[model samples]
Target: MIQQGISPRPEAQIFDADTHLGSNTFSIGPSRTSDGSTFLAVNSHQPWEGAVTWYEAHFHSEQGLDMTGGLFPGSPMILVGHNRNLRWSFTVNHPDLVDTYVLEINPDNPNQYLFNGEWLDLEVRQAPIKVKLLGNLSWTVKQEVLWSVYGPVVRQDHGTYAIRYAGMGLVDIWEQVYRLNKATNFKEWQSAMRQGGFASFNVGYADREGNIYYLYNADLPIRTEGYDWSLYLPGDTSETLWTQYLPFDDLPQVLNPAAGFTQNSNSSPFQTTLDPDNPHPDDYSPTLGIETQMSNRALRALELLGSDESITFEEFILYKYDMTYWADSDVPRMVQMILDAPTPQDADLLDGIEILRDWDYDADPESIGATIAILTLYDLARTSKSFLGSRLVGGEFTSEEVLDSYQRTVESMLEHFGRVDVPWGDINRLIRGNVDLGLGGGPDLLHAVGG
Candidate 1:
């Protein structure tokens, strides 16, 4: 078994950081376009500067590989982009691929754990890590790493835990990207996907031949029923150990839906397209842990693209740049919650609430309401774990928390700008080398921003 390198830390320290990895992708087939031409918008939202930031490049080879797209540093092939025959983009998808097991350690031996009816010894190794100290000084530190039958092991004060995740030892991801880069047709592209190299991503594809596809691709483990996979499993039993993955064909996918378009904004897979064509949530196993929440971006996409029968290229581009949050989205709902709360006596808080009440739900640069809403929500997301996770998963928030966040927003605005009626663009800016531009969109909108 391959040993996964995991740093030992307290269980409480492990938090959900995947909410920031958001992307938006959509494909329109010939039936949905005015000129009978296919359209694809490959938009991925990522940090402006980081290790995971995107770098655009073009790759060509005499071996029939010619593609242009974005990739991270050190990536051998383009992760999402278009070849000559077809274009595809990737949006991050959340599936229950990782599981934690609470191990029953042997009473007498710290290096042994109970498995089935036997006490099995753990695989231990020393991992050397280099640390940089001053300018030219460094230190080498050796850390003890342990591996159990389930996977990497971490010993805590309470008990020992093992982590098992998809693509634990798989190394063919680059090869799969290479194959996707060279595929000339839908059949070839589907064959490449069938290789099952990608662990998680919602793929959006549009071809020159008028074919469009959306796939909720994941290497979901064939977990047994009758157990809550979301909770920690009993490590002492082999029955909780899953060793097989669901087949590629078993995954949720849509090919050339009659609705004429497909979209994913890190939302639920069951609502990828129109009602009759979308994948049913009941068709999949509950152990898959598929997301059932609809993001604001996804809701806007459905509202814009679904209502249009023949979309022109210009209209498609305009829709992609949509800055309005849907009426039923969480943003409007949260705004209402604030309005319905008990009226605050403070003048600044009252003004802030009025600004939000009278303002339209558009994230335009000139919108003053968006300035307050986005800043307040973004601050809440940074400080509260529940708020951050709930933004994507559709979790509930208490009135106290919402009112407190608004109060903080008023204080912050007064401290920084001396007013709460500042324009959205003035507060939300995109600064680069010699170019500081005003931005129009807030988080989770069609034209999304991290702020």
Candidate 2:
């Protein structure tokens, strides 16, 4: 079926256009740190300027509320940050909390739909959308909105569809975040989380009490069995309607694991920590639609944080700024694919391949290799039909595509800089008013910077 307002495209080709929008948050417990002090890093990768851009702020009140962290424009409460006693941060989580159903509309009565062997009238209402025509001039249009037993109804060209999503009418998110900001300990924080107002996020929390926690927090709908929730479901049955959510206790979480650390880089909750501590896929129902993909940031986090036995605060800070891709990650694999392909006769293409071959997989500002590899990968991510996101999992690029991307990178570099060995910093720059600086870290790295 055609998605409303979106043009027809390959399902796999659908991706988040805001590639820079991701986050990395980790909590280190006392047992894993050198000084026996708990540490938490609250890092969110957001656009530098937008309505959702982060602004640092501290909120204080007489009713035992004190928080300092980042929040969106006009947001009264902090979305991710720390208080005096504890700290917590959020990273995006992928859970199937929404489902679309193909509704069987009655041709005899257009507003009536077939459900449970009975004809049900759709709830129709008028929604007013105000459009600004010019300065201080606005036009208000009343649009017809429909609702079904599932949720909102969308009339598509192919058929009528109803979408059901978690937290449909819940509007207490500010209250929950306020409770979280006022929480002074783990129990209080978890109690705040039990409000179940947040729809989806991977929460990384640490407190002065040496307690660390990682929660794959979501208001997940309890769906029926034997139906593929990923695809459109039959709307003509009550079985497809999910009216309840899983209890907050059933959500995947890790509390002060023996591993002493927990992280989420928009990856699978099953890989939040070491195997014994991480959530098991078998425990959750498949209808929940929890993702299983691991991002390169997640893999590198596991490598760096898992290997270090006792991490100092300095080391923790250093690890947070790491820019190297993992050895087994897709970047090196793609580089190898280019090398193993039939050698191109063009000298510029050959030079690009040699630069990639001799280069280390680090997105350092001064590194010439990163310039070639990252530019080519960015091009591939834009042009390749199979590419999805920074994770680069389940996507395939043929040798021809890889070579063509590399050749394009070489040509662009030659055209602009007169050489293929330009430093990454020269191109990937950070500019402000009268302040221009070179920045390190390419996309998907620990210190990710999207140029």
Candidate 3:
């Protein structure tokens, strides 16, 4: 709502803005400037239901961006333009912004819950869910909404538990978003960060002032005494209500470190930049749950960015498209495990094994090796039912076992697709427009979706 600068950059400028500010009940990029300099008015909102239509109307009417069917759930985007000397971009801020606590309900009166020692009355509300069964026929299911001193209470057979997530009952996030869009300098932007209502997602920032910053933004709850925030804690006592948050300075972040660049595709912060400090794991609270897993996309981004000093747009795009998995990566291990099975191998299985063993691990439409490896791993992961999901254990495979997995993939292909020669596109697609176009990524590749 305010403007502070009026200059423009004469060079071939870049303006990138990313957003992760949609509401959980509903749904939610990079940039460059072409007009010497451009300022954009950015705003994102929560969609409690099927609100994608609203997003389409807003962008087409206001920003003239072709964003219909682009605002998928779990994916946030940003818009760019001119506001004066400020050209800003946004990316999601990732931090542990939610917490759950198990409540001890009073046996005599379910309305009263026992916390640390005292009893507290539950806040009650009503929410309706709509479902359609047949043509033009629909029904509504009304559910009781219970709240403890913390936040919303989710009831199950185990017990009633309350979840406390940042901005759970707030609607002022757009205030910060609008301010960031018009901020021209570090001071203005830092002031906006202090306002801090953003819940989670890693933030990527760039400005016309030649300043770039990264913030792992979140409004983390500061718990009361004797309560472990990690697990479900007693939820009935006033003592359990955690209303404070650590200062923004206390949050893990990188601001113009010795490393010139930083990136995150939902990966471990330990490897974001080449800086020595690298946000040590010991510094964050155990309750934060900052993910340490090194995803295929994160690994590839690091490889591409860390390998070069200067980068061009063409190189950035190419890096995004790179599909090959490093040799020591999880995808290759899946292939290697199947190939090294100890069981006796038949000629049919051996042929499939040979195809995978020599694969480049690239998930292009033409790459059969990539197809087999990805499909087999997907099946394995889908079937594993443990609490932690389908993570591979240590030293779990040899060459012969991996070859056997290759044979299984061949059999699966023949059984499901009616042939082993079906194109990868025939199975994987990116549905948009009136066409269901074939997609170009796989489970372990840099650009990927469902494994």
Candidate 4:
């Protein structure tokens, strides 16, 4: 896919990219490996350790108030501490670390499956999923589950294949987390990563020693040659079964980059760093596809974090709450495209366009102009992508349709609010901790999103 032209790349010298704060109470320690070395263990049952430690030690705030137990039942991660001795951060790593293959079944015997002229009984089990809606309203859905030598098998109309992912049955990852928590230097951290128990993530670390590093941390499988796992490959082929993983050193990474910063707002590696310090794209395989989407949040981060030199914590926090639209953002462009088009004959439509063109791009509750413009844009999106297909909408909105949507949306807002002059804050809200406060920034700003 083509990369979006939205520019901005956050290249801060981060101390830590990803680290799950270890919970002392609920965490399971590492087990002995075959070679006798212990595996990494970063996850813990207690998810509040990091947040509590940070709030109490640094901010002098109480711990239990901000803690939300582990977001996921089994997966736990956190980031805290400071200086050369400790720092870490993480990003989601979407690698094709898993695979599934359909096995050819015997037509004569349903219980027996043929593999390499040998027959084996399909392992069967039942999986029950719970569904809950209103109070005391709940139901269960049961599904037939299959298992093979490789792992679980997902049967569908097409066929059945075994499925596998990194660390499917073996290894507890928290062991590595424990090691990193105590690591005091690059070598110790390197040794932690070398353990290779982690399933997935992009990591960045910095220490009080002034050293910085970025790594794609995971146990990515080293599949046998000539298998297209991108789509389901023929499961009958034994070659599809991968027995090894690429070494941690073989993964893409950068250390102490001359550019002084590394940033990835979920975009491709091609643009992770400044021009002179960016990683070579050819280094990674196409099979391990990377993301290239540019989110408005990332774009805004790059705009400020990239160019700022003597940044302060106050400025940083303020930047996080910035809610202004950049001219290059996707939402603004859609609005602009409509505005620059030729005018239509409908009086209501022309009046709407006049209001939209006059908008200052602020979603502030008091800005009637902004309210009309955004309502019109929302209507356009609803008609173009949801209620009406592109064909039904005639490719894109005509100047007349733009006017109509503008008129209708404005009418609805007036009817609902009893006035068209409501403040932007009245519509865009950020609710948190008994606070339903009004906020700034529209749909495409740094603190992006209204309401």
Candidate 5:
């Protein structure tokens, strides 16, 4: 490791990768919308999974439904869109649901465990796992799947653990979606949400009745007050067991926010609207584990949307496609770190630094320095502050790393494209069939380029 550091071996570094779903959704009521009707907009990006398609459903003796979104074949959308008086969409809310408990097994029988001062037998079952060796030739092998009062148990070489996750035995999740589709008003919608099988998602809603809402909806277990839920709990007692869920009314929500708009970019629910209307983080329990980071998309959305009181439909769409990463956002901060650093004496490094400094924050096609700036983040994915894990959710990188990444980006661009001053449009493109268009947005922007 020491010898390799003598030369520029960026490849010697190992990246710690983490990824989570990111999406943007917002709603506007009649007072703020263009057509005198509520406006709901969603840009759910799942590039690997593809986008949602419009669909219509008509059932015998039931209300017809029109939807402009698709779902995974087996999954249901309690986040119904344009089905009734209201339209709704979802952004993933990564609430705490899963918990692990360290098991203390009985010495005489591994199948027995101690719970609340008494030893009890674990409920063990063997399920058949079918494996295929060749085409149409399969074998069934029985694997032990154990269960306990805690929920489920896993035995590994290091230790025994029991896990408890919310909605473990859920079967009527589809029913909730179906009910949500048929709900014509706010009351009906709330009743449907009371069923509460949704594992993760923050719902954004707007209705023809001039109502708008944002909900940080989840089926989260009500954990006990004392223990550190981040670590494994002691399984010997029932103290770690969390049975109840926060009531539907307790989930973070805002209805008809004073700001005239509500939005979530998979960020904190506390900042869903203007400062006056945004939820107070201290009001909710830390045990719920609500997200508190502001995304670049969220910051941009607030700057654009909240700036105007009488925003036109054209402006609404314009705000949705806003591509500039906010000044305080990770991208700009990281880039500034590189720019403010002492310019290296090398010719190419000086050229790279100048490109970054001359660049405007926008990712438009004609932006001269945009190519090198964006590619720097792209080339050094995990190592780049604004490109790591969830950039919008606040990532970090050192000044040294940022400068190194910029150097690599300049080197790569010269070797391949043969120039550092190439347009961002030339490098980052949206290609379909034989046609190509310049992608005007960077990652996590409201107008996502790839997704």
Candidate 6:
């Protein structure tokens, strides 16, 4: 069978280029904390203008809010924590769960499509979308919902596309949650995950007995080789259809790796463990569309913690709070470019450049250089959102752009604080009712907190 239409490089590696996916979240693996307590931490920083919320929540014998099963805040899953036995948390396990299929609509009858050398009629229905116009006035719009042999059909003027995603027709999320919360040991937890209810997530777990595990909770399709699953595929043939999900053991996971640590910074599962021990890409099928990209934090984690054979509790905490950008990160490269860029014969520009040049790269609260450097980096990120991913793929920042951002940062600092040498603690302040303190970390730091 000849494949008709696809991008030239259909098998090109899929990238999690969506910066918004992990903007406010970064999860790390289990490690023994300073208090000798095993901790699996996720930097759950949600921007808020109102009341402060916390993940370290406690629930007594209550219903809902005071209920037996309280929600995980803006989520349908129940809060799973200590119960005289164990504690657990989850990270998003992003695998290719959806595929787009292009079908040839029968020219003779638009309602029918060619599938497996046969014409099958599409199931069409109308979905009512009601909108409120004004006082007691509304409008009901009927939208067409079409179903093809592959899955849901999306009609366009040029062509039609069908979507096939994991957990397409399943509603067993609550059941999965219940089983997860009730699981006592690894055996029970494994059983619950094997049920494949929630579709995709990364499970980080540790128990009182020192058992640590990281599960790439995924129900991936067993796609056939030779077809690039990353691109839109031809739907006319049955060969493109996947029938079963990969078994649990086939998923990438690290159970008490020899390195004594496991982490996923929303990066590829191939980098979840220590060097040489992490899962190899060759072990899994490329058609699964697993990520090959690693986030900045993942690179940082490996750099800071990978070498330590046995980490003390203090070392663990220190590594977690690392604020220095990885050497090869875009921030460093861009900063270097800004420093090397020709100064515009301006006092503020010269002073700012000197400060950045003479200081350390750490986002220390008290560092005068850090204030301008961090602000300028934030400005750079906002202005050029294309620079969000790894430096290798996010396109290099030009010297002109870097100098422009440098000038802007200098001016903004002089305008807001009346001086360019303001301390990072002064700008990145944490304000409560009356108590305000200088915050040490900046965006994408291991301690990742931001507005």
- Consecutive 10-residue window with the lowest summed lDDT within model 2: 6-15
* Model 1, position 386: C-alpha lDDT score: 68
- C-alpha lDDT of candidate 2 relative to the true structure: 0.86
Q: What lDDT does the true structure give each of the candidates?
A: 0.86, 0.86, 0.56, 0.54, 0.75, 0.69
Error of 3 at 227 (Å): 5.4
Q: Kindly list the per-residue Cα lDDT of model 6 for residues 118-158, writing each as its tens digit.
A: 99999999999999999999999999999986799988865
1-451: candidate 5 lDDT, tens digit per residue: 1222221232332212233346789887766666665677876766643344423333323345444445653444424456647778888776777777778889899999989998899998999999998999999999999999998898987668788888888888788887777778888887887887577689998877889999988887787787656556778777688888888787889999877899988788998988788889898887777767777888888887787777788888888888787878766776788879986887877877787787768888787676777777665575654456464546766778877888888888789977778887877787778988876777767776643
Q: Which wins on lDDT, candidate 1 or candidate 4?
A: 1
RMSD of candidate 6 to the true fold?
Answer: 4.3
With candidate 4 superimposed using the best TM-score fit, by how many Å does residue 144's alpha carbon deviate from the native? Answer: 6.0
- Relative to the unseen true structure, what is the C-alpha lDDT of residue 42 in candidate 4, on a scale of 0 to 100? 20
lDDT: worst 10-residue window of model 5: 1-10
Name the regions of candidate 2 deviating beyond 4 angstroms. 1-20, 129-140
Candidate 5 local lDDT, residue 393: 44
Off by over 4 Å in 6: 1-16, 20-37, 49-71, 74-80, 129-141, 309-315, 342-344, 389-395, 429-438
TM-score of 5: 0.89
Residue pairs clashing in model 2 are none
Tens digit of per-residue lDDT, candidate 3, span 138-245: 999999998777878877775777877776776666676555554567788678767875665565554465454556677776655444444444455666576777
Estimate the TM-score of every prediction.
0.91, 0.94, 0.71, 0.67, 0.89, 0.84
Task: Tell me the tens digit of each residue's lDDT in model 4 across 1-451.
Answer: 1111111112311112221111110000111112222111122212223443232122112421121112233334323333225455555545677765557787887655666667788888788999997899999999888887667887666566577777887675667755665566778877977877677766665555555666766677777645444555455545666777777777777666654445443334455545665566676655554434444544555565566544454554555565545556544655666677766675655665666677766555566566666666667756754322111111245555665576677678767886565566777676767988776555434444433
